[model samples]
Target chain A: MTTTQLSPTPRTTVTRGRSRAVLDRDALLAVLAEGLVAHLGLATPGGHPLVLPSAYAVDPSGPDAGGTLYVHGSVAAGWVRGAADATVCVTVTLLDGLVAGRSAFHHSMNYRSAVVIGTARVVDEAAEKERALGLIVDHMIPGRSATLRAHTRKELAATAVIAVPLEEASLKIRGGGPVDEPDDVEAGVWGGHVPLRLVAGDPVPDADAVTSGGPVPPDVVARARAL
Target chain B: MTTTQLSPTPRTTVTRGRSRAVLDRDALLAVLAEGLVAHLGLATPGGHPLVLPSAYAVDPSGPDAGGTLYVHGSVAAGWVRGAADATVCVTVTLLDGLVAGRSAFHHSMNYRSAVVIGTARVVDEAAEKERALGLIVDHMIPGRSATLRAHTRKELAATAVIAVPLEEASLKIRGGGPVDEPDDVEAGVWGGHVPLRLVAGDPVPDADAVTSGGPVPPDVVARARAL
Candidate 1:
């Protein structure tokens, strides 16, 4: 309660304590890029919110100006239809640390997260939409567009792509130690951080990966190492 | 779109060209429990949708009753306060497979997900609130509760807990190989399955873990392997 008045940009409600509100775009973008799952928030026609886990990427408008978030669903997805018309909200979070406390009630987590609030303009045009697809492909495998077969017109029709512009976004992130309430700290609970991580084991190439194939690609290895 | 009309349940959406939308309670529970993160959908005080990424669990009740979901947030969380009196929509999703294709347009993910629409009730009573916190603690670390200190009365008062009964929930699941749009199969795109996993490394106990400070505990090592 005292935090709301003392801390600037204080969230109206302090759900998850002071730890939930992440600040700024640089921190947000880092969280988004490092994380794997994304939450696509859209309004139902009846007015309730629909939040689904989705695979996404931060789109580059190349070397200038702002970026857009790229997300996709089946053309038949109600979420896409929901996204096509309304101002959709998107979020990506990575749980980086699990804070262990002396008491059950005092336990918490430290995480890096990105939350974006924007209207999704459905990419309907052919050329611009290709860019969205490229962002998504490169998101999973860098330099994949040049290596893979291009999309045909029919395949394009079934995929629905929505581009959420990178404006009006904020990241409320908290990382580091457990801010245990004073009384709870000396309660003699095993207190400290259990550092959580996203790690990669040896790559299992496709069963049919070419014998002709070169060494495990540097990009894939780099991405896995980064995780 | 035609799937909505054909579904035997309430408000079932189209499963798309390939049957990706599955409607089952068992499936929903699996998806919600498999992943550690949940995109908790709540309405912001501003009346727009706010999707926060948090941790959650599907808590099944005794023999005659069904399960409910437990999601935690800051006592003063802006969006959570919105859920206290209104219908709350909570969704949890796990991305398990990457359906790669020769064509960029055909890339997809193997996913299992759950969405629950329910009214959240505040855990007002002290005894019940304690149980809720227990669920959250065990949700993160299965057998660690008995090993930790219990919360003090003051710590309990500072937390807010809410439960959303999982009665009117829907689950949509998709898994398996790439549904190559008829033409791209021969395009020689390296495609099949790239499985995603959450693995644990050797346990690293707190620096001051034991009052006497010995080697890492066997219990921690066993838990890491289980994860």
Candidate 2:
């Protein structure tokens, strides 16, 4: 059942930085949506932990317990083979700023992160797989998927989409300036944060596109500005 | 022994995307140095995999097998306790651009990523731990450590520094514009890429810094510009 509050399982609860833990479901979704890539962690057959970055998408109305998070990979990837039906951890982090404290001990980063733990299942249903693929594309460039042609059958066959329920999850956010000790602050040490953001530069069209293709589409321009 | 080329172990070999694999150790180091946070993966005591983001620093002339990668955490953190002497994976990714292919299948991201797998050990040595903490601070803001006072005894006691050898590692890079299918190109579909970069905004000074502290240091400005 969908819940407005994040009901973190015992394993997902934040025990160390309890003050940074956010229990609002919308906060978790915001973190997932703003992030472009996710780090998927799982164990190989030999039991060694592995972490790999992959493009991901989230659907709040998805058919999982609370929602669904989709991460795609090449079907031939070794990690993809091990990810099917395996207990995995998905972590997405967006670095907001760099905290410059008066002392080294107080130096930290301003970031928003979401961690989801669940058993990942490979999507085999053709319809859901196709929709997930579209969502993934739109997640990167909104409205660009509709302008493109349909994926060929062979292309679909080579891709593997893994779905994980966003049921057991936690969100952590650390923002604002550095919290320096009173003595350090009184010492008049320069302290603050420099904001960091992912920004898009001018689009570089393919050589062939520049020669033959028409002007860059409005959707592409909008996507660049949105970033 | 220090080697210039990356000698990937069987587990670190790039079987799926061999063409994108980089064997140069310098490339791996470049990616690590550019990244601010790393996703650390390890199996918890219950055997469930966990992934968390942490600030990290790389020391090439370190005492580890090849080099050393350090990640610090609160000593009270549950994962920090579980990470000591355990097999772990650390992945650092810097997203470069978004590939807008003619079709959804060819859409991808241009990025430089480094993945290191090794056993992690807690830094118990007083000197090494203190040096690692300084490195972590300087890694985030170069030259800022020298400007600050030393860490207090109690502050150091609350921190746990984990070191992982940079021996088993692999680097993958994807750059340039979209590689669309010939058919899609023939259809006159506009395809290109938008470059993405982490940029720094103006420094937001702390309330006390604005009143009593001096101006933002040159090192802080250099760090912001470097990004």
Candidate 3:
């Protein structure tokens, strides 16, 4: 049962920055979908914390409760092995702009971020794992998966796909210009924000593709233009 | 004594993607300096791992065994309080491009990332804390702190700054086009990369600044153009 409102568990609640906390589940989904990279945090066997970047995809109708977030890594990676069946935190952040204030204390960054805390389990089933891998590839480049062939048995075996539920998640957004003190704002010091975005350059085909004399695929062109 | 090469401890070593591991200390510093936000991973009091995004700055000649990386947070934040004098992992990633391979299994992202694992301590000294805060502000906008007034004592009290040494850090970089199987590349499939970069848009002055009829500062304009 998907809910419209985000039900933040006790640990997921935003206690300090209550003003920036967003309770809407759609906001959480938006932030996750817009972000390309996710930081996975989990404890190592020695009890030390480890954080690694991974490509991820979200499936609203996934098998996991509250939907599923798929994160893939090499099966040989120690962090991937350690994350199996363990509670982990996934954070995706999109920096919007740089907030310049009249006072050093007020300098900040405009951003949208989502945090999810849940137990992650490795997907051992072949069918589910293949579907998750395809989702991840499509997440990066929409409609490109249909153009590619199926993954071989060896390739599928070499990857470890972990799924985490999106039940305990929270979103935070801070936008607009700097919020300076009244005195600072009146002091005539310059205060504003520099907008930032992730942009993509033209696609460069590889030697083989160039030699093959094939034009860039429509999906690849569309993805670059969309960015 | 700053070493020229990164001295990765057993845990910091990149065993899975050994080909991408960069050992030069300068490369590690470059990656850290280029990134504005860092994902900090640490175990909560309840032993569950948590990852939070924080603004960070790198100091090459600071009062730490291997220089220092300063990360600031609100004093009221639970994550900040939990990170004090605790082991933590900080990861900063800059996505360079999307690697489009001929096969689904070969799709990947080209990125440069640095991971630092160390014990973080909250800055207590007034002078050091103030300097760290200035660095953090300047890291976002060059010469920004000079235009702003000093931080008030009350404001300082409300902020918590944590410093982690640059020791035990490792960097990974994946560049160029996708590496696909011979069969896939020979099948006339398009393969290449779409370069991605964080760009800055025009500066938008605040209402007060617009009303004051003051031009955007040179530093702000230059920063935007540089991006």
Candidate 4:
């Protein structure tokens, strides 16, 4: 039920805007779990950075639940290969709403974000890699891995899974309505929080499945309904 | 109107998984403009990369339209100071849906993202900095800057604005239903896309304004209605 707290290292510390930084481990993990994708920053051989989008998941409960972040992609991905030993940065952000203020300068957003800094190690063991891949799949669609066919040897070989420890991670959150200046607040100008959320629309079954004539699984239907 | 296309240089080229790469300049700009925040990747003094979230704006149409990305924050921000002449990677991603496949390995996401590789230049001129600040404010809520009180000279001095050119940017997109393997498709399992979108809810007026009883601005009401 608990993970280690965020470290006080210079890289992980929230120096600029201290009020937004969250040090609690569980809160940080919750932010990570809420996001579906992470922006991974890797340093190229030439010393330039590449920030790319990739699906990622965090262990919900286990020894690695709060400490390890699992990310997988095609074996041919250049960033994945570079991340094996190179220092990397991963960020997951969920935008909740737009904070509207009386003054444009005070406008902001209600969001939750987590940033992890570490060197990613490749999961070479087949068993561990397979489980990591499953965590990722289920991360997107809960209970999905159990319903799908197991990953074959060929499929497993074509995938690359990397693990980054959350030793130097930090969570930042901004919530609630706008904090406009006192003068602006009394100026009779409108100010409020415009809530924004990710809503899922009805699913459109694939064309190829029409001929197959198979019933949609209960879990898939349930997931869509919850969204 | 079109700006220059993505460069064919080795670093900027789409070397791996070429199918997801998009070379159209306008397409890349559109993706950048869709997202409210951008994850900026910058290297630390010790050469480690850190990816952090910050508000951003793209000039929609003008001399700098589709070519310049503007990002601003407090002058006290370390990353903003480090990014003055350092190579920076700016990424803006918009998640559209969850692409569910019959097999775990084939599951994917529907997203549009743009990655820009360039060194951020500090905007030091007072006039240009002020103008850039307005551009950013209006980017989130159109026509907002004109109605608000002018930013104080002290506030302007305490802010730093960075500009990165989009000349070496590329857009990567994946949409529609999952492209499961032929065998999986014939396995008679359900597969489809769970469409996702950022929906805006009704605005809740600030508590302080409740007593003032000021009318909500038309632009604020219109923006919420459109969302």
Candidate 5:
């Protein structure tokens, strides 16, 4: 699949010893799209924090400030319903591993994370809602949407899609080995990032899959093979 | 290595959730200990949410409240310094993948997550602070401290160790497969949980290591060999 189109948004953080405190809009959007899941935090019924896991897709084509990002859920759910009033925050992260520095102060890790925060608008229109549904389905199984049964009108009525323009989003990244104090360079201990990764394996097709005889779709195959 | 220890002081919100969520102190601590990383979230300047990545080690035995979870930072860092005043949340999640069902709504993912919300306190004491630092080192690498340079007093002071008591913590989990609508049972889509896993592979030792003419630690070696 093509990488999501991203807009150019400048970063505002200053550097502290090579800290990658800034990443432009496209990099942030791509990181969000590469993700299959996101941890969405919102307010609970009693004013407590409520976090839910959800699927999301990047709509790199919506808002004027920065392309909007989309996340959908049930309309009555507190998170989706409260989107307009409360800030909608969704975070996607990829963990690499432990960075053992020679000095205790220099320890760190390698990770990629994007935090998108903005006001959300419910997609009241029918066409965009259906399209959003398709995008979600495709997100899980790229070409599977074309092969699945169509969503019933009742099902459509129960879902809610919200668009958050990624105007205020920012990305921070850290990688490489531990940045140790100058004197501890020769501490004689193994100190560096132990690379962590999420690797996809060969697909295990379902017993009742319709076209099991054919090779996996290039997209699916490519994704798996990339691992 | 032993897992991070959980505090016995149970709070109301921490006790919420199903049986799976009601883990004993050790159980909660084990999940955090075995897991290599955490997704740390804090409120942004605008009152929106911002989550970044950080490596953390639980202090199983130093403090009265199950020893604070030791997270490091630059002394002048604003977040670590400000965490004590605001609600700081730490989330550790292990995703197990898409649990697909005939009905789209029945889809789910099996995951283990520990959500901890608490006021953080900066560890400023000289002796106790060193213990937190050791736990963090051992947490990352079982026998690491004795393997490297010890922390100097100045380094310890400059490095902030912020601990959040696990009292207000809670855990949520969703596991198992698709519970499809009866009508969708016969729908011809390959449906069931696509099991996901993080497999450890062979460990390639650092090119420059003073191994006493020995192989990797048996447990670490076995972990890698399993994959």
Candidate 6:
């Protein structure tokens, strides 16, 4: 597979501290794929901006592959409506650990984050929209989408799905242990990294399940263990 | 303790999808207190917006208490410098699970999110800046500030600390199992919640620790267990 090069623009450039910026498209895609939620930033019509949590997935094998990030919500969501026409920023971050440095000034977190900037186009076609919705479901738990009840036509109409091309994006990350100053290291403080990971606990079967006595599906069990 | 009410402004009102907006000030504060990172949204001088993650803490006691959220970074960071007078949106989100509903459309995640909107004021005073830095350190690991090496004057001057007031804030949360439609419930599909939790593993002692063989500090040990 040939890879496309993404030239850094003024907006995608990391102008701040350190050399943590990751410019490779594949590297950025990896960060987006692992993250479960994205914080979407949109400006109100009055021009005040707001950042809200949202669920999203990257299309791996489709016309939109390597180009589009899919996000969906209720049809009436103000951001969902406003995003179709306005340029927005979607950020996905995964925190890996708490870096307990030797001093108060140097404490940091081990994390991987990506920010994508673009205007979203609404997926209005029924077939395409349905596939995007399925991608989202399986994105959270692979293979479970096939087993879940299909989306009704009314349910598809009630949902708003938008695709934002991944043309302008950048990734930043920090890892490993505390980078303490020489003096602080000599001061004999208990300093190291406390690793943190997102793990899955045992699934709690819904009490109101109309269908009872069936064993928990193997796909769901595998997803839990994978997490 | 008297709870101050936050009046709903045009920006604070949840004009979007479901009514997941949280109104209680103390409730919003609790979300802020439990969060480890915040994604700050800012517009570039060229009019494009961006969201970047940063470590933050709410000041529990001080002249800035009850109104300020503290964030700090290198003095040379572009976003940190540009954010002083700009109206910014700081969002903190905690993910709790993968809600696998019986159908694709109803899939969701259990999460608690808080969005704070306001202009950030640079903390220019040396003493206030120092205190804010300590607050951020302790915020990640409770009681960490008292044991860490003191911030040297040079480190204080090298950092830029900004305080964004928590006046215009709102909380949104979703919990429990998938809310599947009645028809899907009757279809006998697997439906439940796979809980996702952030857990900490044993601390990896720094290889360069000047003092060796010391037991891990109780505060650090407790933090790992609490996660």
Model 4, A1-227: lDDT tens digits are 11223876878777666877656887987788778889999888889888988999886552353468888878887777788987889999888877778776777888888888887889888888888888898888889999888999999999999898877888878888888888887777778877888878887679987678366667677777876
Q: What share of the true interface contacts does candidate 2 keep?
A: 0.88
Chain A of candidate 2: what's the TM-score?
0.96
Q: Which ten residues in a row have the lowest lDDT in candidate 5 chain B?
A: B1-10
Residue lDDT tens for model 3, B1-227: 01122686777878677778666888888888889899999999889899888899988998987789999999998888899999999999989999999998899999888889999999999999999999999999988888878889999999999999998788888899998899888788889999999999999999899988299999899989989
**TM-scores of the models, in the given order?**
0.84, 0.97, 0.97, 0.94, 0.80, 0.93
lDDT of 1 by residue, A1-227 (tens): 11111122222233444535544455556666666668887767777777877878886452224577888877877678777756777877767656665567656666665667766788888887787787787776667677676677777897888887766665655555455555544444455545666654444444444442334555555545554
Candidate 2 lDDT by residue in tens digits, A13-108: 787767776668888898899999899999988888999889999988889978999999999999999999999999999999999999999999
Q: Once model 5 is optimally superposed onto the true structure by TM-score, how far is the C-alpha of residue A16 displaced, in angstroms? A: 5.2
| lDDT accuracy of residue B53 in candidate 5 | 53
Q: Which residue pairs does candidate 6 place in steric collision?
A: none
What candidate 3 gets wrong by more than 4 Å, as runs, is A1-5, B1-5
* Predicted candidate 4 versus true structure: per-residue lDDT over B187-224, tens digit per residue: 78889878887777887788886768376666667666
3 versus 6: better DockQ goes to: 3
Give me the runs in candidate 2 sitting further than 4 Å from their true place: A1-5, B1-5
Go through the candidates in order and give each one's C-alpha lDDT: 0.63, 0.90, 0.88, 0.80, 0.60, 0.80
Chain A vs. true chain A, TM-score per model, equals 0.82, 0.96, 0.96, 0.92, 0.81, 0.91
Cα RMSD, model 6: 3.4
User: What proportion of the true contacts does each candidate reproduce?
Assistant: 0.43, 0.88, 0.84, 0.75, 0.17, 0.72
Model 2 residue B127 distance off true place after TM-score fit, in angstroms: 0.5
The DockQ figures for the candidates are 0.44, 0.84, 0.80, 0.72, 0.28, 0.66
Off by over 4 Å in 1: A1-24, A62-65, A181-188, A201-227, B1-18, B21-24, B62-65, B202-220
**lDDT tens digits, residue span B1-227, model 6:** 11122565767666663356555888888878888889998877766678889999887564544578988888887888778888998999989898888888778889988888888899998888888898898889989899876788898988999898877777778888887777667767778889998999998778765255266777778888989
DockQ for candidate 6: 0.66
